[model samples]
Target chain A: MTTPSNKLPARAIIREVGLRDGLQSIATILSTAHKHTWIRAAYAAGQREIEVGSFVPARLLPQLADTAELVAYARTFPDLFVSVLVPNLRGAEDAIAANADLMIVPLSASHAHSLANLRKTPEDVVAEVARIRAARDAAGSRILIEGGVGTAFGCTLQGQVEKREVLRLMQALLDAGADRVSMADTVGYADPAMVRDLFEDALRIAGDRFWCGHFHDTRGLGLANVYAALEVGVTRFDACLAGIGGCPHAPGASGNVATEDLAYMLGSMGIQTGIDVQQLLALRAQAAQWLAGETLHGSLWQAGLPKTFTAAAAVAA
Target chain B: MTTPSNKLPARAIIREVGLRDGLQSIATILSTAHKHTWIRAAYAAGQREIEVGSFVPARLLPQLADTAELVAYARTFPDLFVSVLVPNLRGAEDAIAANADLMIVPLSASHAHSLANLRKTPEDVVAEVARIRAARDAAGSRILIEGGVGTAFGCTLQGQVEKREVLRLMQALLDAGADRVSMADTVGYADPAMVRDLFEDALRIAGDRFWCGHFHDTRGLGLANVYAALEVGVTRFDACLAGIGGCPHAPGASGNVATEDLAYMLGSMGIQTGIDVQQLLALRAQAAQWLAGETLHGSLWQAGLPKTFTAAAAVAA
Candidate 1:
């Protein structure tokens, strides 16, 4: 019942997924000016890591077609760690060419989802990671390679993914030459207990090589699951501002956990996530207007700040 | 981490505050049939505890004027623990006469809030609890008394509430013959760390006499705070369905954590909260139509259940 006197110094990293995850699902396409403004504002708000864009085909996701320009703009911020999602080796090459800090190659753990969405099996995607890694080494690039296992918990197309299979794929990715690996509850099926168990086991096998936890608040367990992951020592998390992404297949899958809400949760727990909640909420307000018809999700923006929060002091600085 | 093999027995109780807290805040007044249906559905959904109504003057809270009739109806359910809010001695009489399982008398720790809203100091309120206790004894009533310390975290009129004062008031209520006491984030200013520290202190003073944790997701930390309190062993919680209440004085203060979302969180964590989340969502659907113009808050309703939920077995049952 006692407060931990020297609460462990929270080194939590909140990766801004607004540009990629937030934009892709929403119908509205922000002009390049608004996109750059959002990136700059997020950086100014003390966000050190941001998922600026995805290297998907422009025709499939027209909202994020300006990603290349956005990635180039993000690189100008010295302190910011810019990352992007790459669907294949081609996307990885573009990322390396752009000198992105990190490139995530997503491989859906569910075979059905992998086939339906990516048109590749999980192993095929793992092989691509190897190819991407070899290409990076040949090109003498220092950009980090992340093998992100999406739908690691369950998939809408094929339900109930075995934990053993998920672990095997995670290890297989590392064996196939991925520099780092992360797990995602792409469909928000993970509970806190499941998160703690899977994450602990993943860390035991991968050690420090296991990098981030991506959760969708589609069922409102996102922050709770994050807390469980934190207990097991996972620090970095991927979150979309205003919780902006939804699964196209899953009828009503809402966005990922809202970035500002996550920041607030972490900051209030004495966790040192380097993002200003107030600024994030302000960013949400501007983004909301730009996304008028689309549904936005978050609690902090509507409730405002608690009186105890000294966020105004942080924002003023 | 290993799913705790023997799941934590269903220890938590979600006191349905939708009727009293939800309806009172919104402009809509549901028909008595809908209210009875809500109560019946909630009980059928395994909700053993509910705050059916607030015993306030009809002029003040017209929406809850049928509280007496509702309580009379709720009494028919043998296992259902129906409770009501009693703002003063007059409200307490009505509550005691109705033979409620429990009666909660709210005492605001903030002096400004107490005077502005209740027109009584916190000490005076504690004296009232003593009087109510005497009245119950005189009337040979078996109803339990709960002194709800509202605005315990902070207040809009009076900002930083001292932990010492809150603890003292909590102790005072117990000394004044209140059977149990609960802490509330009336202004939604409490963070998880604060929640842990305060609940720990309160538990130390009251022992098991400290009963429930009530939190407003005002700044999005309600569930986080609830988790912190759980870490310290507080089990029962107060949540409005769809997160439906707010402070009239505080411009954007929202309700407590959405009941359905909280149920999803605890149930997902493998903690048996005895709430049927899907049924809760169904109730939310009806409640939403009843509250078309008002704002509704929750994440799980929009996003259907996660694909991996085997709890569908229990929820379906």
Candidate 2:
């Protein structure tokens, strides 16, 4: 048997997506001021990559209306990788104008969810990526474009998404001028075995062009699925602090894997994520207050860290 | 990268331990009749293995006082593998007399936990396993003996259990006449990476003699750790239905990984678990009714099965 010990990546990036993915789905409209504080606190806690907010029309998603402001503020810190989600060229243009580090254009592999979420077919979204790339170049912006395949696993609406279609779309997105691409278990439908099977093949196809993995802990296998990707060498992950996001369609279903739990899991596994879990827990407490009534998820916050966690001490030593 | 797809076991067994582990940690004293219903329902749900209860003194653990009765009742189901926890020789004698399918003698890897939980050192537990083996032989009982190493990853009271010590105790348990041996993440401290590292080594030493894996979902990586063990081909697992048990010390810490969720994860990955998830969900509802006001864990109950889940239909087909 091949031991994963030797093959696992040394360091992984846990990109905080709570401000965007976490807030957008929940009912709470966190004040822009609270968003700023959350960002600053997360950065202070050693987070380098954060998807600040989505660059959507305020009328459509008022929760993330302050994306441009968040991105501009997050840029004050040197070496911070600020990301924003852009549905079409308008949002992508806003991201580029704001000098955001990266813009993720999510294309759902499930045609039904693609049309419902993006108002475009998967191929149509791919075409939009080409347009967004051209627009970025014309604007002389160095903003990276990532084509993230949402519902890469089965979908709540479409049920089973064919792997062949998912892979074919990934290649198309790359051909359409996306600088990077990633897979998302958008509704938390992925299991580790499925993750290993699909991601191993995706890695062979994309190599370094594969940006990260995004998993929703909806079915409670988010960490397990992430472990499968790690086994195949995908290091960067997208998560939300306190696991704040939940599926609007499926009530009680969780959103992204909780950042604190993911960080703890990765740290204990000896993978450097550069995020201090205690500080993340502090941020989680702040978030819980800001979005008081919304049901929050994440196990680490409840249990705290194990006594064997010496990564914090070792860093000082 | 060696893809984990081909390496994963095609089937797995989830041993329901809610009656033993789940009940012991909670304040709720489910009626013996209710436990019998749970056992019958769990058997109907496709769980072949069940840990009926512990053989410790009734005063110490009143919740499991009806263990022998439950074991005898569970044995009525043909093909059901009834197991019980035996803390010492007297408990083993009761198990042998009751004709239990198996009796697990737990040894804590952490010295502090060993003393606190079992009131014996790791070596003393090993000796007891030898005595239990001899007693079973002399009684001409066909019941199997399994030595389980708890806190194999780390302990709450004492942290950073040495891998060398864990392996040493497992070897000692085997040498002391255990028919089989298993490892447990007793405090939910194990990450999937640690599981793969340790379990791969353990599988090398024990092969098929490694009986089962028991994981707590306290920090939400239980399923992930299970996935890691599956990669190493450890099939049998110990879980509590609805995650009934919480660490008594930890106010809200979860108990064993919920059996339903684990089965759903395995079934989703095309692993044949022989259990029907719908049947398990029905059992979960009954459990929720039986233990009202108690915190129940497991994601599937909230969201129900994904529409893509075809486990039931496949069996029908």
Candidate 3:
């Protein structure tokens, strides 16, 4: 019960995945201008890190076909760290060509998910990360590489993924020359204790090279799990604006934790996440208009900020 | 990341506030039969504790006029601990007569809220708790007394509530002979650091006498605040099924954290809350149908459980 004077360090980074994760799952396709507005607004709200879009083939994901354009637009902000999801070496090339701050190569930990979705074994994806790293060095690109192990917990395709297997793949990714590695509860199977145990172990092996915690709010434990990771000194997270993504492969699964809500949680804890929650809610309203038919999720947007919120003064104090 | 073989002790208690908190706030007045059905189903779902109804005047809250009947029904379950909210001594008498397991007298820490909502000063409420305790002793009743300090963080009417004042009020309740005390972020202005600081101090003062953490998801930091409290060793929490019961005075405020969501969080974290989340979801479905126009808040209901979920089996493994 002793009051610890020093605030808990801000280890969590909420990367706004609204434009990519949110837009891709919904039936509606936002105009490129709307995407630009979202990116601008999110950055203005103190979101320095953002996954602006994905670098998949244009025809495969029409919702994100303007990723190249969005990437260019996001790069306009001086300190903003713009990232793009790259599925393969070709996508990596596109990301490198666009000069994204970071390019994440997602590898599903579930064998069934890897085979069915990516058409490659988990090890094969690690091999691709090696090739992508080689290509980046060959092309003299400075963009960072993040090997994201999706479904690191259990998976919709293959239930009960072994933690040992996830840890091995994570190590393999690092060994294969990945600049950083992240574990994701891609199907949202993680709970707080699991997050604490796994992240603590992963950090022991990967050190500061273990980058972010990606959790889906599919089963409502997203923020709880993130808090556990924070307790264990892992900072940086992947979140969608308005909690907008849904798993296409997993039936009845929802999106990542809402970025606005996550920001509010951090800001309330007196942790410096640098994101303005009010501005995030305003941005959500704007995004809602563009995504009229899409189901947007989040609690803070509907509730608004509490009267006692003095973020400007609190930060100054 | 050493996996600690020592299992986390089960500490969560979902104090169901639907009958009093949920029904009183909403326009719907469920039939007595429906209330009985809810109590029965909630108990069946492993919900050992329930706030069946309030003991306010029927004229003030006709929705809870069936409080006596509901309490009687709840007592039918041997292990179920039935609680009731009593605003003053008169209500306390009714609660004692019903042989309720617990009687919570809510006292707002915010002076403005105390005056406007409860028509009493903070000290006046403490005096009332003394009176209630005296009456209980005189009547030879063994009902547990709980002093719930609401608006402990901030209030809509009075913007910033000092931490010293909240702690003083909490100590006042204990001195006034209340069996237990708990803090509430009634206006949802709490951040994790603030929660940690206050709960830590309060726990030092109240020791094991501090019982529950009541948080509103109004600003979307409800789950995060709960986590902070957990870190400080709080286990029991107050949540509404479907996140119902917002303050009528606070226009944009949301309800308590969804009970089913909270249960899922605890269950997933390897903490035994004893409540079945799937059964809670089913109860939510019935509650939704009964309270059709009411805005229900929860994530697990919309997206359902994750594919990785194997009930208690996953956690056991």
lDDT of 2 at A19: 91
TM-score on 0 to 1 scale for chain A of candidate 3: 0.95
Write the number of the candidate with greater lDDT, choosing between 1 and 2: 2
- What's the lDDT for residue B57 in model 1? 92
Q: TM-score of model 3 relative to the true fold? A: 0.95
List fnat per candidate, in order.
Answer: 0.56, 0.71, 0.59
Model 2 TM-score? 0.97
Model 3 steric clash pairs: A11-A235, A12-A236, A13-A236, A268-B191
> Which interface RMSD values do the candidates have, in the order shown?
5.2, 2.6, 4.9
Q: Which stretches of candidate 3 lie over 4 Å from their true place?
A: A1-7, A10-12, A313-317, B1-8, B313-317
Native-structure RMSD, model 1: 2.9
Candidate 2 residue-wise lDDT, B1-317, digit = tens: 44433476667888999999899897889999999899999888888999999999999999999999998899999999999999999999999989999999999999988888788999999998999999999999999999999989998888889999999999999999999999988889998878888988898999889989999998998998998888777889999999877556434446789999998998888887888998999999999998898888988888788888889532331
lDDT of 3 by residue, B11-69 (tens): 56778887878788888889999988888988888888899899999998999998988
Query: Per-residue alpha-carbon lDDT of model 1 for B78-195, expressed as tens digits?
Result: 7899999998889999998998999999888888888887889999999999999999899999999999998888887778889999999999999998999999998788876688
Predicted structure with the largest DockQ when compared to the true one: 2
List where candidate 2 sits over 4 angstroms from the true fold: A1-6, A247-253, A312-317, B1-6, B246-253, B312-317
Candidate chain B TM-scores, in order: 0.94, 0.96, 0.95
TM-score of the first chain of model 2: 0.96
Q: In model 1, where do residues sit more than 4 Å from their true spots?
A: A1-8, A312-317, B1-9, B312-317
lDDT-based ranking, best first? 2, 3, 1
